[model samples]
Target: MKAATAVAVVVAVAVTLGMVATLAEAGDNNRVFQPCADAKIQRGDGFTFGIAFSTRESFFFNQTQLSPCDRRLSLASGANAQLALFRPKVDEISLLTVNTTSYPAVTNGGFMVAFAGRKYAARSLPAFVSNSSYTVTSFTLVLEFQKGTLQNLYWKRDGCASCSGKSNFVCLNKQECAIKTSNCKSANQGGSVDCSIGIQLAFSGTDKHDAVLNSWYEVSNLQQYSLYGLYSNLRNSLTSQYNKIF
Candidate 1:
């Protein structure tokens, strides 16, 4: 009888922990997406950002498809668009590279924007990720923080460094390095190009303790983090265990 009670208690603990994990995942998922104009950031908290992109004409709330910095974008039916969500620490430097996962493909003449925090936080400019002619794959983002609060998010151009000397890429106006849309997987019937975007992230300004921070040097020292793979493995493991237990 004593052994039986111990087994039961163990199972109860496992179930409770599982439930808590699920709740945490729920909060971290897409629900974190908030309008850049209304996002709120606080010190010692995770900031999940949203980047909406699409190739369709009507996906945007307006004809211009202004950057998230300027207006709120509406994701409606027949929009044929997708939003890529990610969270990175503002107090540290990191490298993030993401490819199309379960989300719809980003194709033909699409722009994207980054948004975080409320009132005091600023969103990035509307960046052209892909066009009918080309698609950009490498980018550097700078997140400015003041007194532990997020201030602004912006993209730092690399002067075509990623595109130079590559046969598949073209240097546009000596500022952007991009590949022909015909080589992108979605646009080309037999193309092998992966339109993955690499974000080299850096942080500037001070933290809550008023200590200056620079993410550039730190990010340069570490390898890229693959959050997608970690999430997938965890979810799959949980699901497998759940099915076996129940």
Candidate 2:
């Protein structure tokens, strides 16, 4: 791939998979798209966030098709939640849970992004993951900020799906830096969301979700408490709910 094209692939992957938009990807570019309309949305409703059993991030990567975010994160968030609730464990294993239906699965017991299983509600609560056997050792509960009309999302991946390893080869020269990205695609199609007008505004803001994954791996960052930065939004929600009851 050429330099700019290579950069686009990287940024595009980051755009779809990682929640936060890499500063490099948010260049002097813009997307001119015809707004999406939905059956549940009233004509006057400027932005429509279609809720369902779950969200599939697969189409998010198809920049050409017009799905927001990619098969990366938000797509997996819904199915991960289902896995958390159904088997509600945290151990590691093989089968990766993904969404089978589009976002409109709201009527059904949350769409089965992947696998045939039970259902759950997507309350404004935080996100979490568990083992197929039953445990919460590494539970990741992300609280959504319903503050913005824009739909921010969470995605999940099966720990045992065999993630690609980062192989740092000994490249003798700079010209040999043609390393390939994971280039994974979401395993779904169709279903569209009607986002409101305000827009993330900046197109590419700090809302990137790589922080969520990094936290999962127990990495450190410029923020003080790990929860303070990437998870502040979710932690606050937990605190608010706690204060209300106790």
Candidate 3:
């Protein structure tokens, strides 16, 4: 009876170890995406923003698409707020260059831009991996901005000629960038000016699976602590409400 009991104990231990190994494998397959390091901004005659990310698994994938007016960041100084908009072209904007050896090739990419309340929103195209259980790491985003001209100007959401609804104009010049909105028809006129600004952006992909990804605009030469504080307050308020319900 002792020998039989010993044999049964060995069998049970083997089964338990097998189960643990399987569970660990499963856990490894579903690892979440890690955040990239905070981007560093350098200011001179122009600006450059660098972003990075990392993953453990070999079969990771990541893709980022940016559009003109897809992301906006704002800064508030007491009663005044400064907003910056990032707008990349839909077809020519290449933010991420994929490495076929390290990561699976990207399938699709593009960008779109829009004007919102006191801000311009830029959006990136969706990114995903063809296979599961892969982690993408060490992705980078580099954006270069200099002075250039933007033409064929028109109102973002309204017909330039009709001017029946709300009207706003965002103009970028050599010295400064400005947005003006007015309710009167006289203010709705559309024209192009010599904008001494040029912008270029690039990004890479990761293995995480999110259908839509958003790239926030980085505001240069502005202090945005107040904006961040307000955002933190709003997030905390929502979290508190959720906790109360749960």
Best model number under TM-score: 1
lDDT of 2 by residue, 122-235 (tens): 222222211111111111222122221123333332232111242321121221111111111112322121100000111111122221112223222111112223322322
TM-scores of all models? 0.63, 0.17, 0.16
Off by over 4 Å in 2: 1-19, 22-225, 229-236
Stretches off by above 4 angstroms in model 3 are: 1-42, 45-118, 129-132, 144-246
Count clashing residue pairs per candidate: 4, 36, 31
Best by lDDT: 1
Candidate 1, after superposition: displacement of residue 58 in Å?
8.3
Please give the ranking of all candidate structures by TM-score, highest first, separated by commas.
1, 2, 3
The Cα error of candidate 2 at residue 62, in Å, is 33
Q: Write the per-residue lDDT of candidate 3 for residues 1-246, one digit (tens) a residue.
A: 111111111110001111211222322432211111111111111111111111111111233322222222111111111112222221122222222221112211111121111122122222221122221111112232111111112111111221123123222222122223111111122222211111223221211231111221332111211122332232232112222322
Q: What residue runs in model 1 are displaced by over 4 Å at the alpha carbon? A: 1-45, 55-78, 101-104, 217-246
Poorest lDDT segment (10 consecutive residues) of candidate 1 = 6-15
Estimate candidate 1's alpha-carbon lDDT, on a 0 to 1 scale: 0.50
lDDT (CA) per prediction: 0.50, 0.20, 0.19
